[model samples]
Target: MKIVVVSDTHIPKRAQRLPSRLLHELRSADQIIHAGDWQSLEVYEQLKQYAPVNGVFGNTDNEDIIRVFPDKKIVNVNGFKIGIIHGHGKKMTTVKRAFTAFNQPIDCIVFGHSHIPYLKYKNKTLMFNPGSATDKRKAPFYSFGILTMSDELHAQHIFFKSK
Candidate 1:
């Protein structure tokens, strides 16, 4: 399965629309996952038009978004257990908090809150943060991610200059 991963869109607050490059990926993805901070349901609605979307709600999300998405979730894709969370909390680093969110074993943890793209493995679990598609914050470039799963899992970050 081909999955397009993104987070912290903050639409209308960050950018008016998703970058064309990301839209193209979403159009071709078998599934789409947003880590959080969508800001509005319109973002979700827009993404759903292209592919199935699995995601959580971030701190900035209102009741409308929180009503549809949880603060954390686990999804099974092609025999791989993936944990999805919007890593926002009062204490501890986002990555540290993500590791503690799930009690069960998970092959990968996908999170977003800091708007910093990250990919690493710790304690044998893959940690992926797609950063922000519409909001780069202080980052040099806007970015997103893609995950391809078959016999194995492959994840990559795609960076660009535009929102």
Candidate 2:
């Protein structure tokens, strides 16, 4: 299975449209996971047009988004348990959510909201954050991520230079 992950796309505020490069990956990906702060329903619709999308609502997201998404979601993709959450509150809060909300055996945790991409593993848990797609700070970069599963899982962070 192949999945594209992105977050913090504060559309219309940060960027008018997604990078053309990202759109190409979206078309090729089997699934897309959006971590949050989407800022517009159109963003979601555009993503869905490319592939199936799994998303979580961020703190900045509206009530309609909240109602549609749980604070945490567990998805099984080709036997890999992937946990999705828009990390809110504090650092500890998100850590706690990972332990309590995701009780099942998980292969990875995908989260957003610091607007900084991170990939780390402690013990066996893989934690990933794709950063802000419409980054207002730090080199004006937009990014997303990709996870590929075959014999094992492979992940990469993709950064795009905004012109």
Q: Show the lowest summed lDDT stretch of 10 residues, model 1.
A: 130-139
Best by lDDT: 1
Clash pairs for candidate 2? none
Off by over 4 Å in 1: none
The numbered model that scores best in TM-score is 1
lDDT, candidate 1, 1-163, per-residue tens: 9999999999989899989989988878999999999998999999999999999999999999999999999999999999999999989999999888999999999999999999999798999999988888899999999999999998999999986
Q: Residue by residue across 80-149, what tens digits does model 2's lDDT show?
A: 8888988887557555555445666788899888787778874587888888767736745677899888
What C-alpha lDDT does candidate 2 achieve relative to the native structure?
0.81
Worst 10 residues of 2 by lDDT: 93-102
What's the distance in Å from true for residue 27, model 2?
1.5
* Backbone clash count, each prediction separately: 0, 0
Q: Tell me the spans in candidate 2 whose CA falls farther than 4 Å from its real position.
A: 91-101
